[model samples]
Target chain A: MDRLRQHIEQITPLTNEEFEYVKTFFSLKKVRKNQYLVHEGDEVKYEYLVLSGIYKVFYVDEQGKESIVQFAQENWWMSDYYAFFKQKNAGMFIECMEAGEVLCSTLEAREKLSADLHKMEHFFRVKLTNGYVALQQRVKLLLSSTPQQRYEAFSHLYPDLIQRIPKKFIAEYLGVSRETLSRLYSASK
Target chain B: MDRLRQHIEQITPLTNEEFEYVKTFFSLKKVRKNQYLVHEGDEVKYEYLVLSGIYKVFYVDEQGKESIVQFAQENWWMSDYYAFFKQKNAGMFIECMEAGEVLCSTLEAREKLSADLHKMEHFFRVKLTNGYVALQQRVKLLLSSTPQQRYEAFSHLYPDLIQRIPKKFIAEYLGVSRETLSRLYSASK
Candidate 1:
């Protein structure tokens, strides 16, 4: 897809022939709202690249409370990465939040692509570097940030997602109560 | 340098010539206990790979409360990664908990090594993949797990760390109060 080419080219340029080869590894899938792309207990066979729309990667604990690990929008990648990398059964679920499409590729394909092309290896390394930093920031915020600080950081980092995502999910992601989130929301406005 | 070669070789083997070239990019530093590798507001320049001893990567908030982000031991790589990668001033500090030796490499060196050697690129990518998964797991634990669950998970993941790191720092890392960590510690034994 053109979007795929654009995403890859954002990190490293691919020749037309290389792009053609790379595209073969990805298959497109259309998902509907509320559809589950990955479910807990199933083998996590693929990691997806969002073509359009939004999705949430989350897990439900023993107490039956759900905690969202991350949200993936267009051009973002999503999977239960721990399980995905280890080739184990999923410990989380990736649910479609809006009707959209994604390109799916297996770990084998990912390894093959990187091994076959130096540029592709560089592209993946850069992407992972960014992802690693974002997760580290998220951990720090979760550990020490106040509700107000968390809300502010989330808003600053994802101004676009604030309006697109439901306030309830935003509250959960911030680990803030709905009332507190509402107060912060109004104050910010 | 042998440790460095061994660490990289765990993921991808390198010829002696390749290993020799790679080792030049890193400089060895001996750290004293209480010495700070990184300080809040200082520009982060290098990421260190631990050869021996322990280090805490942490931050002090406005309230003067310290939170441990991670602990680095032998064979572990540690940095204010978000700052290190972005070439920005650190918001956290990495302090040596015990006298140790570290191999310090710059961002420029990392990129150059990866560009020069495909095996090095693959090695870095694999390391980041594991680090990313570990951080994601931490995020999930922080968001939903109870103190007991967090302690158990940490123990399972790093059994050696439990005895090595002080209970006080472990409490901060797990986002648990000292009393709660004491209870978990006693219960675990």
Candidate 2:
């Protein structure tokens, strides 16, 4: 809860009373490695803010191939956001890669908090601005970057996550083959 | 400026006084066909909200291959978002494909507007939320969708754009070969 307060305050500070009120809308949940916080077809009721550990938000197509959409770590938020906002069944899965805790809040909670606190709205807007930029870069990499370029860019962008995430998942996230990723890794070393 | 006021009001209604203050931060520009609003290496200053016509946002890699990132039409916003938010040089280009009018605002103006008006902050937050979700869907399409699927999805997601955008640019946007896009086009027929 203190971490949550710190995270919020990092953007916009709140008084003890305001913080307490904000916390009322959030519930802390312990997530085990391999836990699926969101499953395909299930209602995306809560968006989670990771407190620790790693998680992957992904899509699995009809051919049963997994496409990593985004990854979440401590202080990051994850949900089948399209489904969450639209109140539809999840089209993506959010699976924990390592044991950790996350603070969960409903979309209603988010809107209520924003409506109640202008600072919260500003905080959310700022967070989304950064998220939007990251996604734009992702699209650019997907569109124009070569395998080596993509690998290097990914490494540079998520150096910490590179060390923590499995090489296989990193390979998938880059849309590069295992062999190519291995080649890039060895070449870089 | 009525359009700007209407756009802001669509999310959060603004008072006459507030709207008057808000409009001061924006300048409207009429763009002609083939005009470049942004070019790689230029200082990225403003994000634009379209009032008419179509614009293509794209990137050019080392080999000078163009990759279409997005097409903006009436009511759509376009910018080198990464650079715009970071106050850096543009890494992508925004070129007008059809003559149109756009409202432009600098990052400072954006921040000032948000700080001055809580309603404006909420409005921006909601827009960013939708933009974030749209980007997530774009990433998903890039990572997992086959060419045929991508074309169909693009057609479904932006039916109006399909009718207006050139097939070649659509091919680039979908990361499909021109021939493949043509095949998909005919196959659908």
**lDDT score for candidate 2 against the true structure:** 0.93
Q: Give candidate 2's error at residue A148 in angstroms.
A: 0.9
DockQ of 1: 0.89
Which pairs clash in model 2? Answer: none
The reply for model 2, stretches above 4 Å from the true place, is none
lDDT of 2 at B120: 87
Interface RMSD of each: 0.6, 0.6
* TM-score, per-candidate, Cα-based: 0.98, 0.98
Quantify how close model 2 is to the true structure by its C-alpha RMSD in Å.
1.0
CAPRI verdict on model 2? high
In order, what lDDT does every prediction score?
0.94, 0.93
Local error of candidate 1 at residue A158 (angstroms): 0.6
Q: DockQ for all models, in order?
A: 0.89, 0.89
